[model samples]
Target: MKKTQYSATRVDIISGHLTEVVDDLRLVDVADYIAFIRCELFGNIADIVNSATELTFYPDTLTFGLGGEYTLDWNTAPKVMLDLEFKNMGVNAYFRLTLGADSTEIDLHHVRFAETGRSPADNTALLAAAFENARLPQLTASENLG
Candidate 1:
């Protein structure tokens, strides 16, 4: 596997559009954090990569600005899959998530739950939850990654 880095430079904080927001740095951080959880849950990065599965979070774990305050203290803040569980709560998983392997890719069409019955607001969240935990599932085989 190869190591990947992403950024939210595409998001325009100053432009308040009707669309949703995506934080790139947070996305990368979330991916890193997911790998950590998956490694602990699965075994090694290789297992996770070989598993070739996309992870989704439970609706309950989809807790974001839903109902809480935040503390940016690294030493004191709630440690978790930070970005997934906290930062980009309103964003879709397809836009936020990626396959464990570069050769692999997510195929499901991600969209919002319109009155048209497309998908729910947290569609991606509901989409990626592999098990009970919203843990990410990949470990890059690069020298700097896994």
Candidate 2:
């Protein structure tokens, strides 16, 4: 059975409903995903530092939804670090989004989630969780708020 290497486009982003298969994302996909999430949560994707291979978003606050247990207040440590690295893996290229000082990698090359599938709303929730997970530790340590 042949697997599909879906191009990371705006439509793909929307079709996935913001619940992207982290392992199937391209570099641009990561940027678009973040932009989408930010837009959904904060109303717009302004002042977002974007480049060919990287992106940086300094939002005023990172809020989880009504059910979210995590929130990162920007008053103390304003920057929630998210770095995307484009790499050549010999057979193919890989896009990796490394979050925070620990560099916890979210590999978009895995086929697990892509095989199972998730709803658009679920995808959004996943991104939100990833966003929260990325900054929770720092916020917890610096401001003592999680």
Candidate 3:
């Protein structure tokens, strides 16, 4: 049997008015606009693991009665498969605003492990911090965009 692989779809953020140049203005003037524009970019990855256990075989052994000596063995063991879906909802918006400009790329590399029973609000803080850290350099560089 052939194995199956899944691919994530790419999402783009539109940069409508950012391309327009205003008269008598500097790049710093649009720093907030650029930050706001780029801040809209977001992505999500949903990971899931499915497992199953089952007892399939039983054998009767030596001195004891068949029922008493019988032992059970599991045929199927627990298995986990990682399924990841990537979304790039606003990447285009950020790229359009920062591309060709002296802006630094934001780094969003982290493996957040949520607790077994945690509320969405509980994770929001961590996520917010991660995002802030990722955008800090870009926001700072926006002031010097030429």
Candidate 4:
């Protein structure tokens, strides 16, 4: 419950699969969604996560995944989900972010589909969907967090 503040400049995203699509996504929110996720991770640690993140969209599905957990002095780490959707300029994408307990580094993965013809961005008008939820916030570290 710490009062963690957020800034858009903090979250940096580098797309591994489609730079053009990522650029389009940024054009819609101007990186607000990315910043919010970074804010959630930063809230867990006293300082911000300065590590560089490199994520790629699924070649087939065009979906991306990123997750990480911070070590907390407290007994348990909180689990939360933050989902985001962006629709603009013939681009649709979904982001699903989550935070849990016990981890040092962050990992980015491409969500694979069992079917051969599974495309996340099938439509141009808000057709793509990705979800991201981050819950690490140094929940019980400082008194201010309550």
Candidate 5:
């Protein structure tokens, strides 16, 4: 008998829009915080990537201000794959998230800003800062489900 793989579908359970200007080092901090939020929503980075197959939320997770007014179907246009949307010094920013080869690693496949006022170097620096600050959530024993 052959074993069947059980793949899970990921859903857009949460979304956030910037309420304040995020620039300088704050941009990185916000990115890290969002990453932590993702880990909290899912058991791990792998679970988040596998989310395309399944959408499950962690028990008692706090996701304040992350819920958007609308939700897009997983296969519809303007899909709900965006993990973050922020404003950097007034520029509309976004991130498309993906998982790295390592099950524990989460990568931001795309980072785009709606405005074109900043130079390429400035944007790169901002993104690098975000990646540097990104950290996985370290859930407590009680919070960690088997």
Candidate 6:
């Protein structure tokens, strides 16, 4: 199979909203916000590839989703999940961005995800920088990648 190189940038705008709960009760919320953005990026990359390489991304042949666990504390820095996807040949790739363990403040986390089977090396740096620039606030981390 021939290898095609592809790259794209996506942005998501998330709003901050949470329901009230018991004063001392503990809870965990599994938001599909990051998953949604990942799907959008995948679609964008697929479109670009189709236009440039004439290789269509058949829905039946492609699958995209997100799954992860997060913990929120009273004084802990806010968390933002940066999700990305890449597809080439028969391989799919994903990357994530979050507050680094050594990061002092909660800044934008740059997540770079890509799919393999293509010229993965061709635009790796460009794609990495693109995702790095698509940072958002932890509160609006679930916004759709535009």
Q: What TM value does model 1 have?
A: 0.19
| Per-residue lDDT of model 3, residues 1-146, tens digit only | 11111100011111111122111112223333233324531111010000000011011100111110111236532221111111121111111112223322211222233443555344433433333332212334667785
- The residue-by-residue lDDT of candidate 2 on 1-146, one tens digit each, is 13333424312332232223222233233345444555554222222322211221123222111110111365532223232321111111123333332223333432122323676455434444434333312243657653
Q: List the residue pairs that clash in candidate 6.
A: 14-140, 86-114, 86-115, 93-114, 93-115, 95-113
TM-score between model 2 and native: 0.21
lDDT of 4 by residue, 1-120 (tens): 111221111112312223334334323231333354456543322111111112322222332234323233457654433332322333334443343433211122222333345333
Residue 32 in candidate 6 has what lDDT? 35
On the 0 to 100 scale, the lDDT of residue 94 in model 2 is: 26
Instruction: Return the lDDT, model 6, position 28.
Output: 21
Sort by lDDT, best first: what order?
Answer: 6, 5, 2, 4, 1, 3
* Residue-pair clash count for candidate 3: 0
Q: Which stretches of candidate 2 lie above 4 Å from their native place? A: 1-115, 139-146
- Candidate 5 regions exceeding 4 Å error are 1-82, 99-117, 126-146
Q: Give the winner by TM-score.
A: 6
TM-score per candidate, chains pooled: 0.19, 0.21, 0.19, 0.22, 0.24, 0.25
For candidate 1, lDDT tens digit of each residue in 13-127?
1111101112321333434545555455423332332222223323343322111112234464332321222213333322222222222122222322322443432343333
- lDDT measured at residue 143 in model 4 versus the true structure, 0 to 100: 68
Which stretch of 10 consecutive residues in model 1 shows the poorest summed lDDT?
Answer: 10-19
lDDT digits (tens) for residues 30-124 of candidate 6:
23333434455445333322332222223322222243223346786445343324333333334332422333111123323444443545445
Score candidate 5 by TM-score against the native: 0.24
- TM-score sort, best first: 6, 5, 4, 2, 3, 1
Off by over 4 Å in 6: 1-64, 82-84, 88-91, 99-146
